[model samples]
Target: MAQVLEFKLPDLGEGLTEAEIVRWLVEVGDVVAVDQPVVEVETAKAMVDIPCPYAGVVTARFGEEGTELPVGAPLLTVAVGAPAAGGPAAGPREGTAGGAAGSAATSGGTTEGSGNVLVGYGTSEAPSRRRRVRPAAPVRPQAAGPAPATAPTGPDRTGARNGNHEGPVPVISPLVRRLAREHGLDLRELHGSGPDGLILRADVEYALRAASVQERAAKAPAVTPAPAPPAHAKAAPEGIRTPLKGIRGAVADKLSRSRREIPDATCWVDADATELMRARAAMNAAGGPKISLLALLARICTAALARFPELNSMVDMEAREIVQLDHVHLGFAAQTERGLVVPVVRDAHARDAESLTAEFARLTEAARAGTLTPAELTGGTFTLNNYGVFGVDGSTPIINHPEAAMLGVGRIIPKPWVHEGELAVRQVVELSLTFDHRVCDGGTAGGFLRYVADCVEQPAVLLRTL
Candidate 1:
């Protein structure tokens, strides 16, 4: 006798409320062990594998690949109990529900539960047996009900409208409910397009738009004339439409918000990086582990930030104050097939060039593989953008939102410049700093950029801070 249990999508931390199914690891009727990954889902931050807490035969699955499900939505159902003799176990027999429940309670082979606290399951231990209660008999319309001319069919509609719905409202996000309330729309009047009739934000928005159009039509005159297109004009062909979702969508939102909210300023300078290149070569020639050019630049950025702490801070709009951070959690932009992700190297100020190089390499590999966790993708204090790899000479990078500043580095190329008094071919690179104007004025921004340029011109300048 097997007791069926339902497992819902768990919260994958970092304030993520929904995830798109990437792949399914288990199939219906397959036996799964406790803590086994059942499906891989892509959230806004990263791709994650969700584990099943129950060990049993998978009875049913909820969503197909690429289907997006909200947190607390049913992912699958598992039939738990001992396997039947000499064959795959079967579902519980009808009318033996009580007997099977009792048997499962006393069964020695059954697992108590997997003590895992993910999104759906809490920290509490798993219950020994699921409580089964007899459902009330369905209410049938009276034989004389044919006399009524106006009776509603299907699931109760007036429950949500009258605010007396007993069961769950099918809506997942609070933001969706808020949107409906603000527009004076009733959630009950809408049909959800999601799985199991779950209400979504788009559904609410569409209802609001429809309601607005209806209201305008009722108030306006119906006999208005319309204008026609010119005979010389031609209809446009439809283009391929790509959905703005997942990582690309997240990037779009963040960049748009930064442009809308932050008052930013950009300053750039070309520096003779020949000395820095030579110093890096010399260090590699005598070192156990080779130091990377990015690491050296990162070290310089940290030193520059130490001198001008205002750049290493964020503006707290709610607090109406600038929050200056003591420690530097440095973030570097890495481009992958998925998209551009800035992986943060925590406590970067305390790390030496070698350590920073190693950490950068590790994070870059993780980013390319799409295995970087949500924690690795957030909590950045200041960002260092190395656009040099893209073969670009200069760019005014949009500051990563909330972070006060971002340092952009361009490709180092050999250019004719004055060495001492005479002309010489020297390695030169363009450095740009994009800062939040609200945090500091141009003077402070110029000083910070100047220090970085100085370090590039003479690597020894960084030794003073070291």
Candidate 2:
């Protein structure tokens, strides 16, 4: 008889706790080889393909597309020792018990066990023969009355009374529960729309939004007049909503934490980048591999950090000590359609302009394609944000948390300036430094920004450090 093995969602690393099913590659009863990708999931960091470790006939799939499953949740179940015949399993024969045994006999004849170790299962050992059993039923959310008929509701109203409910709440992520508790919203009062009626973060957020709207409506007077419509009609419906669950949510959480925890301050300086622009043009003209403007700025940043190491450090709140890093793992912010992502270049201080240019190009392409791995998106010791692409003059950037500072580069445009005691148009750029005040004071931050400005004003200053 074929033994059915369950495959749970593997840990995609980088502290990701859950992933949403982007697409399913296999269907129930499809024959699959070992290490074949069965599903593609999108985590907060990136999209990952999950491979099935068992080589057999797929008997069941757990979640549908667009459903989010927590780590260790069952993804699918494969019946090992099934017939090796291509296509779905055949119906049971006269001697077979419920056709499962016959399907196993047919598929198991030629299928070999996979030695791969997935998130929750290890296939290194010899296969054990066991009868296929049906999985236990999942906890279903109690059906609630009709809500606004706009979106899905959460738990029922009386289900949460006195916390005396018998069964466990059908919530998946702890984050959802925490959010409801923080907002004083009862989870049991809303209905869940996820598979098996599992509560999702979006369901809670929608409930909260609905409650807030109702409360405001109650407070407002009933005699208010409607305003005139604008020239262009709204594209979306009145109650159209987008969930902040994936990359957008991750960015929101990080930025919020940074604001809440870091004592940050911003300093700005206007620098004449004429020399830097000229230097870049000259290098590209005489270069084997063309150097990028961002690369030049990054080289200058590494040199500046060397001179003022205080800014290249993070505050260890638990130890209550400032941790100064020796190597610069440089992170550059890239804005993509999905949102803003920072891809890190490892040991950036040691890389030359050519290497940095190549690395930046590779990472930028990957970022645009949404193919950057979790490793490439994390472990940034320092960040260099060039917001000039947006045509903005300057901005006080929020420091990527745990990183002490972020250097923001503005658009270098032609502006009237003093050159050789004569008025002339020069390429001027604004540089802003947003640093964690806990790691260093304004004086240190000023020194770092000044060094960077000096290099921009005179590229020759960077050559000495190089």
Candidates' TM-scores?
A: 0.74, 0.69
Clashes of 1: 2
lDDT of 1 by residue, 1-466 (tens): 5566666675454556678999999999998876678998887887777767567789999999999887656789877665668875443332112112211221111111111111222111122222222223222112212222332233332223424557545553444566778888777776554433446566676677777788999999877587787898887778997777777778889999999999999999999999899999999999599999999999999999999999999999999999999999999999999899999999999999999999999999989988787778888999999999999999999999999999999999999999999999999999999999999999999999999999999888987999
The lDDT for every candidate, in the order shown, is 0.75, 0.74
Worst 10 residues of 1 by lDDT: 106-115
lDDT string, candidate 2, 1-466, tens digits: 4666656665454557689999999999898875578998887986667766566788899999999997656788777663456854332222222222111111122111111112221111111221222213222111223444543454432223324467656554444566789999877675565433455566677788888888999998877677878879676667867788888889899999999999999999999998888888998999599999999999999999999999999999999999999999999999999899999999999999999999999999989987777767888999999999999999998999989999999999999999999999999999999999999899999999999999999999987888
List the candidate 2 regions with Cα displacement exceeding 4 Å: 81-117, 120-238
For model 2 the TM-score comes to 0.69
